[model samples]
Target: MSTVLIVQFIALAVSVLSFGVALWLYTWVKSQPSKNSRVETIAELIRRGANTFLRREYVVLAKFAGVAAILILLFIPHPIWTGGALDNILMAVAYLVGTAFSALAGKVGIQVATIANKKTAVAAQQGIKPAFLAGFRGGAVMGMAVVGSSLLGVTLLFMLTQDATTLLGFSFGASSLALFAKAGGGIFTKTADISADLTGKVELGIPEDDPRNPAVIADNVGDNVGDVAGMGADLFDSNVASMAAALVMAMSLDNGTPGKNVLTVFLYAALGLLASILGVGTAKMGRGGSPTRALNSSTYVTTAVYAAITALATWQLNLEWRIWGAAVIGLLVGTIIGLATDYFTDDTKPPVRHVAKASQSGPAFTILSGVSYGFLSVLPAMVGIAVASFASYLITAPLGAGYAMFGIAMSAVGMLSIVGMIISNDAYGPIVDNGRGLVEMCDLGDTALEITDSLDSAGNTVKAVTKGFAIAAAGLTVIALLGAFIAEVNEAIVTRGLNIELLTGFDIMQPDVFFGLLVGAAIPAVFSAMLILGVDRNAQRMVTEIHRQFKEIPGLKEGKAGVTPEYDKCIDIATTGSLKELLPAGALAIISTLVVGFVGGVHAIGGFLTGNIVSGLLLALFMSNSGGLWDNSKKYVESGHNGGRGSDAHKSAVVGDTVGDPFKDTAGPSINTQITVVSLISSLMASLFLTFSLF
Candidate 1:
């Protein structure tokens, strides 16, 4: 084998082995440690104590420094063992640096949080509106730190390996800085979004007359700054999904030469940022009552970008053996786990008032409403994943055979992972919070409370479903990484034997036949749209039922002032129209992916897929936050604008929030945390797969 390929294989092996050992150790420690017997079993106790110690800040720094030193020692060129030590050392350094960078970035994140707190104080004092990005300035700071560290680390690694250290170091340094800045920014952005969700959804409550509402302001600061900015950081800085694109780009480079800019770093970053913004806007679609189920815009855009990038790298740039088929399989398995979890946990049962307010249309409406509601709540996310995956293939037609298929598989995994988490969180949070809100009211009798209590239990199940998704994501990420490694190894063996026909089933052409491709692309959108409409219709039925119940209750009369039918109708209209608005996002994804694919060739599919998945995840998170902020803002604004405190308007704000538990923070940040972990797994898994082929 050539020296470079030999090095690549060695590096890949080391990464996979090291990661496996670390993961196994972590899991074993977690499962075996006794909570109550903290001081027992000398060896086991020592191991537990050691792990705890390692997690400490100073200890972590020392470990990182030690790993760095080891890399420097081991990366030296040698003839021993076929000159493979250099490759293994290089791979080790990559992991060590990545780990160190992540740790340092976290410290920076803490500092950013402090700054946000200070800013919030200043804003409160100055009577300025609180903006999400003021807090997100911390994320920017973290991004800058990560970028700086990554650049320095990569430059040093390169310097250690090359003969013309001075010249190569300078060029590599500059290029690494540019790439790291963008990549680190994307990471920090996702972290920031998670942090914000942690604070906004869990730590804080909806305030009276909050200015963050979307309806009152033409340019809501939260949506523009908090949601968009945070998402941008996540996609650019933290996302592993982008790694596949990066690998494809690197593979296209001329013999690993340091000269040309192989990657379209700027363009990809822009697309990633766009995905984040789109994600924020589309988050509301996940809500059961909102219009449109086909999938969020983020997924469409991200998948397209990933595909386009891969296609360009392969067909136009002539890159080869860049796709990870096993990773795709692992992802599929994980998605199935997530979907099963969501299916059983989802609650579509009628509320207590359903019987009292039953429509003359009878049980048929009830069943339809239940089915519609369930479909609406879940279908958009699923469909979005499917569409994003299929569209990625169309965008990679020119990348020869295997690459396009791999892109689709990766996209499918990425999008599904994201959607599963969002649905899980949203479904769980509302019900729990709604119940908590009722408890806090102290107005309901034991009987009414009991009914709501049942609703709350159902909500917990929803939360469990989300947890199941998280479990699946973590499992799949590991599996995908392993799968990708195995596939690469197998492919290498086949190539060494000069065998071309040993590749597995269902290559790139399966999803690309005229009707098949169209169907694949359209199905998600169509299903999602149908689901959204169904949810809306179901919600209207419930609202009408609730209204009738109130009217019929002899002793439980409506107050002199309550939301009028017209007001309820307006809410229905807003939600129903949202789906139609969401359609444009999917359109953009499809159009953009196809256009980019046609021009760039099939390998560009990697780029489009990466972009779409990143976008979808970001969008899902953003939309949820934005929608919540808007809901809260509207409540506060209406209360203040209609009249001062104690007015019916004010009361409504209190009651609406209290009853709905819209933000779902009443219990804790668990739901937001759930989504955050999901995001983290996506990034980690992407990295694993992308790096596994070549370390």
Candidate 2:
């Protein structure tokens, strides 16, 4: 067998091993103690509500995917009547497989997370160590499943078809699922979160996660859908897109050795997965250790391991050393970006404290301070992405024609090499967050609540860091995808017997390109606004339902025995409203990309994608960091830094957190998927645009 086949088989083996580890972690989490009846009851309610939302969400997504598949069959890459039917069929099948694998990863995450919440709550009664382990392990299941499935799917699909275009179809499938999963799940989560906070904390003066709040169950369920399932799909999309983009560029390289670039990507990705598995295995906190420290340490360990292994592989395989350096550059920049995000969002940092101090004056000051910090926070990440892309391109430009772009793709892979660990840390936030809520609702002692609170706080900090990292990775991946788009367009022009010389890159001097650039820059802003507004509208409806329950349900506020507020009603409302609101926002993104492509052809689409990446990365970092800063500020205030809970400062901080919720959760993360979807769509439809356009 060729060395390429050997490397592919090795990647497949590692993927299978990762999946096995996920299964083992799931069983281990299940084995943890969960004997409390009240905890069981509440956990079951959260589980059922989460599952119900997912079921309905998937049904709607199925219809969307169906229509999208039909279109792909008819028009993508080529017209069906042009004797490209088999390839189109393969592309459609690959697309469906992408959606199915992404959905399955999310489903697995939700199942394990719901079970782990109850386990973590029960373990919290023992001490912080066990509770931390339960939450971290539960989240690890998602981390492993996502990375494993993404790697396995990409490798297997490529092995079967050996076609980079088909891989683009698979990546598009993942992007489509991510769009709905992230947006729909975001709306569902924030709607429940805002309604629960508004009525339960602001109006009633009750504590958070109070049993009397009708929306409390929905709130817990939202954590699973939004943070666990939604985030899993987001990262899955990024991971798949990174691999597909790299493979596409590698296929176009004029290197003397065939398959060298392809094998290098596979080897790097496989090594990264191996590194993450080792990091997850070794992650542990000693007695009384800080959860934050433990999480950060594990991330550092993964980065180190990935660097060492990939360096060794580069030496052994005789690959381009500059490309390896580019990957390291990406990894280091990712770490730097994460640290910058932590500085803005961590409670131990000045940004959160500054926001908390500003809250003493009023909500306006809180908003002003948080927004300013949010904007400032964008600088580091933006610089990091720009530096990584530029440095990688420079590092590999001397090698050959297309190697520079391939190096940038490698950098994205390097940055996301430890995504398995990042997902674990990110998912841990929601699991422990749910643990805190469960501890309160089940009436666990103050000791248990305190322990879970600390764990949850660490989860939040790590989550902020991971969100920054994920966005940066996606930004780099889409940049790589843009390169792939150019290559695809050139290849189509050649295959169709056109006499035109193959184009190398987009020219900013073109009028149509400039026009598309201007319009594309506005897309992220409008898309974000639509999502945030949907949250606003849906939250109002759920808040009204909460008010009605309090007024109509006799003795619910008084905690009358045997009288429960209608929790199911609130869950249903969030479910219905989220699905309703997500469609238009998704449609807007898809339709806009098509309109630009049809109007101005590939050059315009090129300009459009560049504008989208620039603005999308800016808004995503700003929103995510600002929202996290506000959240940590609220927590800092509640911890007695600026007067304890219920103080004027606390109230003001709550308002900031409320505003930041949708910014971080719904709109910020969803933009990453929107950019990827547009890039892939442009690549897949390059032929049509190249052959026929008004401009």
- How many backbone collisions does model 1 have? 57
Residues 1-695, model 2: lDDT tens digits: 99999999999999999999999999999999999999999999999999999999999999999999999999887989889789989999999999998898789889999999999999999999999999999999999999999999999999998887799999999999998999999999999998988787777778889999999999999999999999999999999999999999887783423398989888999999999999999889987899999999999999999999999999998998998998899999999999999999999999999999999999999999999999999999999999999999999999988888999999999998999999999999999999999999999999999999899889989999999999999999999999999899888887888897787887889998898898899999999999999999999999999888889999999999888989999999999999999999888888998899889988899899999999999999999999999999999998888877888898899899999999999999999999999999989999998888778
List candidate 2 segments past 4 Å from native: 254-258
Per-model TM-score on C-alpha atoms: 0.36, 0.99
RMSD of each: 19.8, 1.0
Write down the TM-score for model 1: 0.36
Write candidate 1's Cα lDDT for 1-695 as tens digits: 54333333333343334234323423322233122221122113212221222233225334434643463335322222545565445544544444445444334333333223223222222222221212222223333333333333433444355321121112221222222222222222222222222222222332211122111111111121112222222221223322332332333232345322223222222222332223323333221221112122323443344444434534553333233222233234434544443343332322212211221233343233323333343343344344544555555435665445445434434433233123312222322222222222323344433333333333343343433333233222222222232243333345346443432322334322232234323422332333233333433443343345345544322233322222223222322332223233223333444343344322233333333333333333222322222233223323244443444333433333222221222111112222222222222222122223221
C-alpha lDDT of all candidate models, in order: 0.31, 0.93
Pairs that clash in candidate 2: none
**Model 2 / residue 667 / CA error / Å:** 0.2
Q: Which stretches of candidate 1 lie over 4 Å from their true place?
A: 1-83, 130-133, 143-241, 244-261, 265-267, 270-378, 402-487, 494-501, 505-695
